[model samples]
Target: MSVLRLVLGDQLSDDLSALKDLNPDVDTVLMAEVRDEATYVRHHQQKLALVFAAMRNHAERLKGRGVNVRYVRIDDADNSGSITGELARALDDGAHEAVVMTECGEWRLAEHLAAFAEGAGLPVEIREDRRFISSHDRFRRWASGKSQLRMEFFYREMRRETGILMDGDQPEGGRWNYDAENRKKLAKGVTPPDRLLIPPNAVAREAMGDVERLFGDHFGSLDGFGWATTAEEAEASLKHFLKDVLPSFGDWQDAMAEGQPWMWHGLISTSINLGLLDPLDVCKRAEAVYRAGKAPLNAVEGFIRQILGWREFVRGIYWLKAPEYRARNFLDADRKLPWFYWSGETDMACVADVVKTTRDNAYAHHIQRLMVTGNLALLLGVHPDQVDDWYMCVYADAYEWVEMPNTRGMALFADGGIVGSKPYAASGAYIDRMSDYCGACRYDVKSKSGDAACPFNRLYWGFLERNRGRLRDNVRLAMPYRTLEKFGEAKRKALAAEAEACRTLLGAAPME
Candidate 1:
């Protein structure tokens, strides 16, 4: 019997489970640019262009291999604007006996597809997504009896299971993490190696035009759009990273510079998340580079941990604790996100710089996401939903499985201590140490209180004082809480008042 195979925008790999058993002549690969997925959270214009271009390219590659592919453009006259609607319309035409699809990344889409299958009265086979190193069952088995799921432990297990960076039975360099060595501040007169910018091919240019015309009012700019939209281009980008950027990646990975958005970063997450590159393959190549004495162990290990460790860990947590996980507001933060987040109109140099980069490229490195925008939101008590939505909408690599845990758990501490051992809360001091943005900032990063003080400075202490009841017992926060006690009630009140004034100036209503 003939079958219909479905491909999501992110599932662009030729080896995707849905296409493994394909009969090129009988099976029609169904790919659609649905409006529902595109406008789910008002995604950035560049994100829209990248996904669409990549999807289009993947479809053409399939067709060139003698596969019958039914591709639906977003602006098609008869387009149904929803995945389920498109699938139902296609099935009703009676070309295929059944529907076959690989499992989707998002819970919402997965549930919708499953329901559609049941309602349509057709035989549907949903295959496992094998692109990731760890399967859901494997992750669940690893986490079954554990009281607390720490990424470090999970990462160690992944290394043992995959034999990546392992010296027989032991870890390379006698350690699983090189994160400590990865925190060096960027030295003066030192610059990151030049990045290879992939120019927009004809397909990408068309997709860019479509995004500009259709999603003009989206959050990000479509100018200077340069992302790999196919597997070949993505592989080339990875090779460039291995050759030029990997050596210094560990030392300066956390360092941020003004007008240098891509500093020592791989910039391949968009491609990897889009199924253009396999995570295991990327990790192995980095290991090979280290083995060859090209890239340092710290840099290679740090890079490998991001994919084999954090990337896999987050996906596992998402699947393990989703649906309810999305509603988690452990801190009870109810404040609305400030308008400056979208407009990049803040006087805080760090926040503005990160926001501008996000708007321009649909990306910001981990440190910028974690310590700057994410840290400020945590300090200011922005609601978890607001924080999650902003993160998911702005980044090209942000699929819900990865974005939610990073935003709600790691960034905002919204899940309490599930994804992270402690809140990633810090004052302006942390920002000043890691980035040069504080040097150009209008507010004084050193000032602890008052109008001229950085908002982060006041908000840090204010957050500690405000949340002492919930966080005081935690061992990790004991020192900060003790310091708050040493400040006495009068100093605490003053700090709170300073935070209130700063929030008022920024037009953020106080969180109850």
Candidate 2:
């Protein structure tokens, strides 16, 4: 029987479940660059280029392996512009007897694919994606009866299961976490290594051209598109990270310089999310580096934790509480995301630098995401939906499963502490300490009020006051709450008013 096998842009792995055990002679691999996905959340131009180029490259690989392949480009004259529309049109030709596909990445696409399966007329088999280390069933079983889920605890379990960096039954170096050591600011004149760039190949250049012509209104620039478009390129990038950058990764992982965006981060997230690089392989190699004494235990452990801990943990949590999780507004924040987010037209040096980096490279390391843009959005009382949308829109590595939890749970505290122990809200002092953006800023980081004062200073206290009823009793927040209480009722009210004024001036607060 001839079966039509569908491959989504993100499912480019050679060993994808749907492609396993296929009779290439009878099975035709189907891949398409559909319009709905590219424009779904106004995905960044680099993100669009990366996925489309990768998809095109993977299709050629399959064809080279003697597989019959049918590939559709975004600008094809007969394109139907949607996944289901393309699938239905393919089935209407009666060339194939059945349909097969691996599961999709996002909730919206999953629902759409499920609906297509229900009515596709032919028998359809949607197989599990085994690219990730923790399967959906594995994560669900791990989280079955927990009152509250935490990534640290879940990460330990993953360590035990994988035997990664485990010294017998205990963690390597007698500690499971090296996050404390990872927070040191970059000392003056200490520079990060230049990032490895994969110059756009012919296939990638075609995709980039298509993105510019079609998605001209997208959020980011395509000027320096350098993302790996195939598994081999991704592996090469990973190798460079381990050799040149991993040694100092733990020491300056959280540090941010004015023009430095990479800062010792492993820039393989786009590769992993796109299935060009396997997550477990990335973790195992880092562990091997620690065992070989090439990289410090602190650096290797921190790097592994991101993949084996937070990355897997967030994916599990996303499936556990999604659809409902996205609707949460525990703080009732109602401000719109400001225009400066798009234009980078604000005096806040940290935000402007990060936004510029995002537009240019379609990437900013985690600290830039969480501490800079994400922190400011939470303080300005931007609604969770707006915050989530912006994060999803701008980054090359963003897919719903990873982006939503980080935005609502870690960044905005909109999910009310499900994905994090406490909101990552902070004042300008934190930025002043970790980065040099404060030194060049027009506003004073130490001041607590007035126009020339840093906006984060006033808004930090306001976030606490606005959410007091919900957060006052939490153990993690006791210190901040006590500090707010010491300010007296009058001082607290004044802080709230100043915060409101800052939000209004920043255009975060909606005009009535």
Candidate 3:
């Protein structure tokens, strides 16, 4: 029987699992730009455009390869505004006898598609997404007896399994990680290498116009929309990163600079997450660069670890614990997100820079996301749901599988140390050591109290003081708790009061 293969916006690869066994003559590939997915989170305008344009381009490429495709535009006259609605309409039109789709990256959409399949009165098959090196079941077996699921241990096993950087069962250069060497601050007077930016083509322009007409008031701007919208463009981007930026990527991957949003960072996550670039392929290329003496071990290993290790590990944790995982707010953080998160109206130079970069580019490096914005949210005690929603909405690369784990587990420590052993709570001094933002800020990073103090310094102690009962026993946080104890009651109270005033100024509610 002929099949209707459903391809999601992020599942744009030609070798996608659902399309692997496709009989081009009998199967009809179904791609849709549904309002349900786009409006689900008020995604950034550039994010919407990028996905829509990529999907359009992928469908056209499939047609060129002689595969029958049924494409639905968001503004189609008979569009039902949802994935299930569109699928049902397609089924009723009697184009195919069975439905086939690769499992989606999100729980909400996965559940909806599963329900539609059961009710569609047709044969349905949901294939495992084989895009990653680790399968869901394989990851589950590896996690079956572990007390703690740590990415480091999982990464070692992945190295052994793939033999990517393995030297006959041992890691290359006598180490599995080069993270320590990857934390150097940007060198003074040294400029970041320029990155390749793919201008929006006609297809991307139409997609942008659609998003502007539909979601103009969304949280981000589309003025500088230059993300890769096709597999070819994504490949070109990878080549550019390997050649120009990978050498310095390790040295400054954790550093942030004023007005330098793309400082030696690979801008390929959106394309990889969208299936325009293969993760494994990208990792191998980085490895090859190292083999050819083009980049250092720190650069290559760090780059590979992000894709092969963290990326796969997060997907595993998301699938293993999700639905219930989304509600895990171990910190009991209930404060609302600050308004400046969306508006970039804050006087905090570090935060304002990150937010402005997000608004303009729909992107930020991991440190800017984790230390600046995510750290601020965690210290301010923003609710996990609000934090997850904001992160999911603003980044082009964000999907629930990846964003949820990073936000709730790593960033907020909302999962009670499931993803991170400790809350990434830090004083402004950490940022001062890593970036140039402190030099230009109105508040003093050196100050620990009062109105002109960096809010991070005040909130750092306040978070520890407030969560001591829950976090004091954590070994990783022992020193911070001990330091808090040394501060005595008076100093702690003063810090708490200062933090409260800072939160109030930011329009966040005082901790109850």
Candidate 4:
């Protein structure tokens, strides 16, 4: 039978299941750059360029190997502007008897494709995407009866199942996690090594131009665009991280510095999510460094956990409880996202820096993402819909499968306690301890009540006080609740007032 195999932009791996039993003569690999997917969120300009460039490069590679690839450019004259429309266009020729594709990454797209498959002229087979450590069935089995789907416990299962960092049923170094060892702040005068920027090739430059012509009003800049656009370039970038950056990654994985956005990070998430780099292969490579004594256990283990544990765990949660999970708002945070999130026009140095980096590089390290942007949004009680849309629109590595759980569950705690036991809510002290931004900020990090005090401090207390009915019973937040209880009712009320004032300063007010 002649099969038309569909390859989504993110599914660029050569060994993708949809192409497992390909026939070069009769089977065609269908790849399209659809407008529906690109404009779904007004994504970062660089993100659009990166995916299209990577897709084009992967298509070329397949063609080089004599594979029949039916490629569709975003600007094609007869482009249908949607994936389902493109599929219908392809089937009009009656050139194939069956359609095969790996399941998609996002629920939005998955639902669209499922509905299309029900009435398509030919049989459709949506095969499992084998790129992840956990399948839908595997995650369902693990989360079957559990009351709380903690990532730590889920990570342990992945470690044992993959035998990564394992020494015959025991974790290497007699520990399953090195998170405590990985929280050191960046020491003064200890400059982070420079990140390697891969120049855009002709193919990438063309994709970048197309995104600009089509999406000039998108969220981010196209200048200084240096993401690797092919599997070969991605592998080179990974090797650079393993050799030069991985050694110091552990000590300052959570650290932030002024004027330094790429703080000892791997910078490979875009590649991994794009299927240019395999997650398991990347984890094993980091593990190999520990075995060879080239990198420390803390660094290797910390990095591996991000991919094998946290990355996989979030994907599972996204699929396991999505469509409804997207609307969850445990705190009923209804305020609009502050304007500075896009403009980097805030006096708060940490937020401005993170927004600037996100605008310029289409990237930021985890600390910048979590404690700075995400934390502030949580404290501000911005609606999950607004926060979720901003994240999906801004980051290059973001897709709904990975980004939603990280934003709603881990960052915002909108899912209550599904992905985390407690809200990651924190005061200015956490940022001051981890970053250099507070030193130059207009507001004092130490002051609590006055306008001169950092907004995060007041907002931190206010977030807890406002959500006390929901969060006070949480075991992890007991100490904070105890401290708040000692603050007297008057002090608690004052904290909430100050937080509202700060919100006004940031150009947002309490939701009506």
TM-score of 4: 0.99
Global lDDT for candidate 3? 0.92
Clash-forming residue pairs, model 2: none
Pairs in steric clash, model 3:
none
lDDT of 4 at 208: 94
Task: Specify the poorest-scoring 10-residue window by lDDT in model 4.
Answer: 503-512
lDDT of 3 by residue, 70-138 (tens): 999999999999999988888887878998999999999999998998888989999999998899999
Q: lDDT tens digits, residues 1-512, model 1?
A: 89999999999987999999999878999999999999988999999999999999999999899999999999999999999999988887888998999999999899999899888787999999999999999999999999899999999999999999999999998988989998977899998788997898899999999998999999989886889999999999999999999998999989998888999999999999999999999999999999999999999999999999999999999999988999999999988899899999989898899999999989899999999999989988899989899998999899999999999999999999989988999998888888888888899999987878888988898888888888999899999999999999999998788877777777677545
What CA RMSD would you report for each candidate?
1.0, 1.0, 1.1, 0.9
State in Å the error of residue 293, model 1. Answer: 0.7
- Candidate 4, after superposition: displacement of residue 450 in Å? 2.3
Stretches of candidate 2 off by over 4 Å are none
lDDT of residue 464 for candidate 2: 91
**What TM-score number comes out for model 3?**
0.99
Candidate 4, residue 50: how far the Cα is off, in Å: 0.3
